[model samples]
Each structure stands twice: as C-alpha cells, then as structure tokens.
Target: MRFSWLLLLPLLAACNSNPSAERGEPGFGAADPESPADATALPAPDTASTKAVSAVSDTLRTVRQKHNFSNPKGPADLFKLVYRGPSILDGTGEFTITNPTGEVIFREMLTEPDLEAALVYEMKNPTATRAERETYVLRRIDRFFVPSQFHTPAIDPNAAFPTGLETLERATWDDLQHRPDAIGFDYLKGKEDRQRIAWSPLTKQVVRVQ
Candidate 1:
C-alpha cells in the first residue's frame, strides 16, 4: 500500500477557485464621502435665487476640459470629467470621468457644499443679484477642467496637508511629486480649501494628493 498526495489536488484547486476567497485591499480614507446619498432638491441657498428646479434623473451639464488629465502622453481632452445632475447646490449631483472610448473610470457624488466656494464673490457685493451668483458657479464649473487647474506636479513641498494624511496617502503624494508628467485636478472645496486629485499609475485609480 502506498500513500499518495495527488488526491488533494482537486480539493485544493476548488478552494482556490472560490470567489469568496477574494478580498479587497485597504486604501487611504478621504475627507468627503466617496458616495453621497441622493437628497431631495432643496430650496436654492439664497431666497433671492431662482426658483428651485424639480429634481429628475437628467443630464444637467457636461464639461470636457481640454487637457490630458488622464494620461501623460494622451492628447488634449482625452478624458471627459462630466458634471452631471443639477447644479451642486440646487440638487444632488455627480462627477464622472470617462475615457476616450467613453468608459467611465471614476465616479463620485458631487455634493452641494463643495461648490459653496462660488458664493464668496457674490458676498463681496451685498446687493449681488441671484443671476450673478449662479453665474459664478457656472463659470467655476466651466473652468474646473481648464489647463490652469491641472498641475503637473500634483504635490507641493510648501503645501500643507491640513487633513493629516496617513502613510498610504503620503506614499501616493510622494509618488505624484516625482512624476513630472502626472497631472492633478485642483478645485476649491470650501471657502478656500484647495483639493488636489490625480490618477495614480501605481494605484490604478484616482487619489487625493496631500
């Protein structure tokens, strides 16, 4: 009688093939919720603002910034980061980034408070009309994907990471700082809170640069 181990091959293979065995790795946390719950359309922030528009799952606006934000050698406007749904402040919104072939690589809820920075200009003039304030957000969104808003070196040595990023985040920030061709998205979150987001070749996903 001979003892053989070949009988265990199929059992071992079956365990390896089980889908449940797969698990997601840990990633750095973000300040904002990556996915925002859909909220009912609220009255415009200002009483003098335009009448609230009814909420519907419709395309509000789409902006394709003419820049190679997704890839280093890619042509201009290779990626279209669309601003969908109604204006961030008026209704629940979403920001989705699509590749050249129209495949969405990144998707995130666009919260209203993020665009509140646009209201600062109107605050300057106590009598600023509602239309003028609305225009400010429109212009801010239009320029959201402009070339000027995309920085080559995502991370700045002098820039402060007020959020106190973790080890994984610091690694990603350092990684972007070294890549000269890597482009990052720069936008205002609060009054003057500038946020930097970029597609990390290493992470194979979009990450907030410190």
Candidate 2:
C-alpha cells in the first residue's frame, strides 16, 4: 500500500508538542508492566555485532568529513543538509545536523535516497531477513544522529515480530522506546483504523493515534 508522506508533518508536530504527557505509561518511559524482571537485561555483544557497529561508526565519520558535515556547535545552528549525488551512500541523501550534545534537533520521514538505496540493496540480499534489511537501512542513514544504543527499540516480548518491509518502515514510532522525552511517528493499522500514528517514544503511548 502506498503511504502519503505529506501526513508526516502533523504527526511530528503532535509528538514534539507534548512528549511528556504519557511519561508514566509502560513502554513510554516506564518499564513494560507485563515483562519479566530480567526482560531489559542484555548480554554482551557478540563478535559479529561488535564488528558491525564499529564499521558503521567508521563509515559515518568518513562521510561526515568528506561532505563537510560538521557537527552543530549549538542548538541555534542545527539545520538540514541535502545531498544530490552518491558521495556518502549509493544515492542522494539529506540529514539533519547534530547538536554539540549529539541530539538530533529535527525529524523527518525516511525519504532520503540513500535510505531508499539501502532498502533496495537489502531486498536483493538472499541471506537477509526482512527485519535485518530494514534495520540495515535505518542504521546506515542514522537520520536522527542518536547514540547507537537508542537507534532501535528494545525487544518487547509482547509485541509480535514485524511482518515485512512495510511494517518495519513504519516502526520508527517505537524508536527510543524507553526514554522520557522520546518522540517519533510511524504508519500503523489498527482493527478499525489505518493511518500514521505519532507517540511518545519513551512510553509508546499514542498522542495522535490516527
């Protein structure tokens, strides 16, 4: 199904406007009430995961220098940078400048060409699962310029595995799903509704469920 990217603006506005309203809810900023006490326990990264993370960090550093994309010195200096060719990734791209504190000051949907290319590349990889492909694309872009640890959601034992690319593509709503001010948006389909949903990433509580 085709998604209307235009709907993203209002969704973002809603989250940015009231991120603290649901801070106490499960998966918002509080621990999931239904999860086991050890659910948040994570083991040390394996050799492969460690190597992959290091590779991405190195690539991002090179891309930042090659493009002259210096980190923002302050919040007032943050803004979008657009790319028209294959310098950083295999295609065109755009990303926000990260603040000196390393927080992303802007948010946008995944419309960048580099992300699109990554998706295409992942689709062609015979050994990659759908989740792996989507994760690859998101990490490669790092649109939010967030810390690697907050790039994705924690394992939610109650949440079903995402079905495919479309579902994964809309999974940003759950990004940083355990921080008090975490905010993001995504496309979701409920029993009687199908539209983009904006929510507090810290709690996963809906601010605008439509």
Best candidate (score: TM-score): 1
Report lDDT (CA) for all predictions.
0.62, 0.39
Q: Model 2: per-residue lDDT, tens digit, 1-210? A: 136677687897887753444664544456565577645575655787453433333333212311111211222324343434323343334544444455654443334343544354336655766566456544654442323212122333245435443534334434423332332233212122223223334343333322
| Candidate 2 accuracy as lDDT | 0.39
Worst 10 residues of 1 by lDDT: 24-33
Score residue 113 of candidate 1 by CA lDDT: 54
Clashes of 1: 0
Error of 1 at 158 (Å): 7.3
TM-score of each: 0.58, 0.19
At residue 51, what lDDT does model 2 achieve? Answer: 32
List the candidate 2 regions with Cα displacement exceeding 4 Å: 1-79, 86-91, 100-176, 185-210
